[model samples]
Target: MKERIRWMALHGFISGVSKLGARRGDPQARLIADPWVRENPGAFADECRKRGSLIRCRAAFLTFDHGVAHEVLRSDDFSVLEQGSNLPRPLRWIAKKTDPGLLHPLRPPSLLSVEPPAHTRYRKLVSSVFTPRAVAALRERVEQTAASLLDDLDGHDAAVVDIVDKYCSRLPVTVIGDILGVPDEDRPRILHFGELGAPSLDIGVSWQQYQQVQAAIAGFNGWLAGHLRELRGAPGEDLMSQIIRASEEGPRLNEEELQALAGLVLAAGFETTVNLLGNGIRMLLDAPEHLETLAARPELWPNAVEEILRLESPVQMTARAAVKDVDVAGMRVQKGETVIIHLAGANRDPNVFPDPHRFDIERDNAGKHLSFSGGRHFCLGAALARAEGEVGLRTFFERFPHARLAGSGSRRDTRVLRGWSSLPITLDARDAAMSSSG
Candidate 1:
């Protein structure tokens, strides 16, 4: 029965992708929400497990003018996909030349774009900044930021407040700004860049939006350039200063690379974290009983955050390209084909996560979720993202134990970023105090 259902789901997904378009945000959502797909949580996984390697599903969504349509593929068989041939063209261009405008190099970098030597060099260069110890050092600062944000929400009596705008979105932006040494006044401007960069998939760039993004990119680069100049003359104790100093080497990031790195950090640091927070808050609120359970046992906050990420990963999927003609599952994938890895679907795989739909905070495998992804492209800021989420959830429950979703919240239209545009939440100060007191 289960096998039959899985087959039906795969067929439905293929049909939907064929009819609506592979990357269509609305259609993809509909496909994901399909009864067949939901019922066969392990459909793709089972296929991969059975094939003993990557399995390709026959589905072609229309690609952007620059992109090529190909079959959807998955593999639990290989630890990492082979590199060189898999490099997507846009990323290939950036890897070959330094382009600052590619702010959020969410795709592979030249260093990370290929295998071995180059990947090693790029990883070595940026690894120090994102080291676990470095991220851990920011713990107290992260906590303070969470506390400060909660404090600001203290007296608000409105029936509902958009947590996405009010709390979830702001915390990471502020934290990333602090890390990059972005000036106090310029934080909002940098966040504007994040807004423009946060779309689900790259809609072939709109000229107006492109200009706005470019201007913001330029503004940030100019700021970093001045900072780099200052740091060159007199060193400081921050990530920017470190990057500036590292550039003294011959292969250092050029002006464009520097800006791209800075912008990537700023955009990703805030955007992903915001989604994590927003999704976490919405999940907790949807299950008030669980929220109450969490309020009673503060120790469970970390695990709760993990479960939230598991159930509601902020990033739904990311695209990769085939380097050469390869077979996945039973189908042949040609070179230059684009493959969309569905993180959201993978996270909910029933074989891996039992009763996957239930938001079980006490689930034993909570920490193992792929919300931060896996392999070479694992989120560099995973540690920082975790710390921010842990602190954010802890502080929110401590401050507003009775907080509840007051109205319907809207999800961002972008499929890649699966989060609330506005999460209306209400807090009862008196209830919070009573809960704490008891």
Candidate 2:
């Protein structure tokens, strides 16, 4: 009920503002101008397909067709926008005023927001560090972290606990924090900033939510600036120190760029992993058979993570503006036009995956989903995310095999990201040994 009311209020606010400036007779203007489109993207896509796969909405085109979505994502003629502000004009103006630092034009663009050359440079800088070997090196640490987290939760004798809050949220933050040399005490703050800024990833966000994003950006950058300063004087054995050393030794990033890169890396590293763990666990709890199967054959945890990513992707959609005129799915998309790829919908397209909606851990081609996206923008931390998901899932069920959903879960009301805000569950320590013995 609370989520519904909030959704309705937000929808009304955005619609009211958009209608005030939107041209009534303009079909193209109604594309993303319809605020409700964000809430029911699959339905909106179905409606758009009446015209064509690349039907224009307001000024941008939305692709729900799987093949077209894939083609658009992989095309080099498209580029990310300079600042894809999700807020309507008035709301964005207010946000800019509330925290000007967050919208600083000089602020370094993160990998998600940066176009090539710069994007290429950032990817090259971090790719080698996340190689298979490097990710494997962290496997034991991720397992230990996950076990320690579940241990903390299992220590509580309460009948119900918010698993999202207690376990899912902390594991990724701790793992990423440890990698980045962020102190134990500061991990919580990093998690808070990540949560606060996450909604900004959506194509549209409310004024209040935009304000929260701006504040989060400011707080995050401020913290990064201080941390970078400390790392400069006395180097450590962490990734940040390695980055600082690289910057000093070679063609380097300025201080602001260095901080921006670190913030981006840390945020990306933790954010998606958190959702993967949360969403994967929720799916298992919803399907008790799958939960039992996973418990009995823990080797399937990797496949389970991939399936969860396909069905309920952490990053739901990404947009790109056409750099040159090109024909997309039989429609000519002109330069400067934006193409929105609905990844979640594409993943469910039956044309690509046979019986796409079913949750099957043994699904043969599950990794084919565009959940991590494609082309030059493919997720750099894919290996790390997968490793974290595998370990997190295995440790969670092993510690509390009998855990069951205890209450209704509340999902985060963000369009770009999908995951629960709170998932209440009950578990008993006694069930662990009993289930293991059986």
In order, candidate lDDTs are 0.62, 0.74
The top-ranked prediction according to TM-score is 2
Give the per-residue lDDT digits (tens) of candidate 1, residues 95-167.
Answer: 3443343333443443323344555555566786667777887777888888888888886655467888889
Candidate 2 clash figure, as a count:
4
Number of backbone-clashing residue pairs for each candidate, in the order shown? 7, 4
Off by over 4 Å in 2: 1-52, 84-99, 103-108, 429-438
Candidate 1 C-alpha error for residue 419, in Å: 1.2
Candidate 2's TM-score reads 0.86
User: How does model 1 fare in lDDT?
Assistant: 0.62
RMSD of 2: 5.5
lDDT of 2: 0.74
Give the CA lDDT, 0 to 100, for residue 10 in model 2.
34
* For model 1, the run of ten residues with the poorest summed lDDT: 61-70
Instruction: Give the number of the best model, judged by lDDT.
Output: 2
